[model samples]
Target: MNRVILIGHLARDPEMRYTPNGTAVTTFTLAVNRPKTKEGVEQQPDWINCVVWQKTAENCANFLRKGSKALVEGRIQTRSFDDKEGNKRYVTEVVGENVHFLSPKNQGNLFDEPFSPRPPVNINDDDLPF
Candidate 1:
């Protein structure tokens, strides 16, 4: 019920850090454009917070940069904590499980080679019949 899928451009390079327990974590914002216009004017872009952990986190930090288009699949997470000023702050983020490179057309490729999307895997469950 918490799943989320997003395809957008990165607003900036990921901010990567390691937890005290030594787990790598990366956070970034994705700019998703609205498909529709408002009153004949373009709508403002939507910025979504995304996070990745461990190997995924490292890969994100290494390969992704500002303005890079991305496809991400993850689950929604929200947490709250008290800041130094004692004000409670709440943030929502997508914890990434899958990431696909989608660099922008205007900037050109960072890597010369093209990458393809993964092929779908056929599923045959015993509960389902043809």
Candidate 2:
């Protein structure tokens, strides 16, 4: 029962890499905004690290860019490794199960199309069937 769902924007473009066994892997950071406190204090955004594997990883790397909105569904995992200074470091990341792109294809053109005035119809009130 360990699952997590996050909706956020990409902090940077997804980085794609391959494992020794040639498995495609992609990594990215999601910038999720935190809810304000009861005292109305602004909270800093949470940068969550996410990882995708195989075809999904390839798709994310190919389509996702910085500032692209996405919905990530995954599980949390923690791993430990030794740093350069010989100190053990622990890192947490989400292993993505599904990644949904939320941004429109042409975001910049979203508001570029101005509203147009409609033309008047030639129908008369006397022709109404009601």
Candidate 3:
């Protein structure tokens, strides 16, 4: 299975656009920090390109902004295209299946109220086959 999970901060505000078919698509760059070396020096963050589709794209565009923390779960995809200069350019990006906003509700353009976790369900001991 081709899958990836990334937790990072948005490098900039998400860019939202509509396709000719009116599908919403949003693109953003995630700044993921690299692990520290043995010398304990700080490493430059990896700027990863990510794409979100449909209503999720709209949500991302509306709520996320520069410096917002988020978790992205999706598959990595790579494609190539010819640029205006006639040079072939390759791009690797994560096509987000789910994007969770991790920043505090008070941060950026998030919802007014903080999100609460759902209550856990109670299960009987007999429900287990083992």
How far residue 50's Cα lies from its native spot in candidate 3, in Å, is 0.4
Against the hidden reference, what TM-scores do the models get? Answer: 0.77, 0.78, 0.82
Q: Best candidate, TM-score-wise?
A: 3
Candidate 3 C-alpha lDDT tens digits along 1-130:
9999999999999999999999999999999999998999989999999999999999999999999999999999999999999999999999999999988777975653456675799989999898
Error of 1 at 112 (Å): 6.3
Clashing pairs in 3: none
Model 3, residue 124: distance off in Å is 40
- The per-model lDDT (C-alpha) reads 0.87, 0.91, 0.94
Cα lDDT of model 2 by residue, 90-114, tens digit? 9999999999888776642122224
lDDT accuracy of residue 43 in candidate 3 = 99
**Worst window of 10 by summed lDDT in candidate 3:** 109-118
Better of 2 and 3 by TM-score: 3
Ranking by lDDT: 3, 2, 1
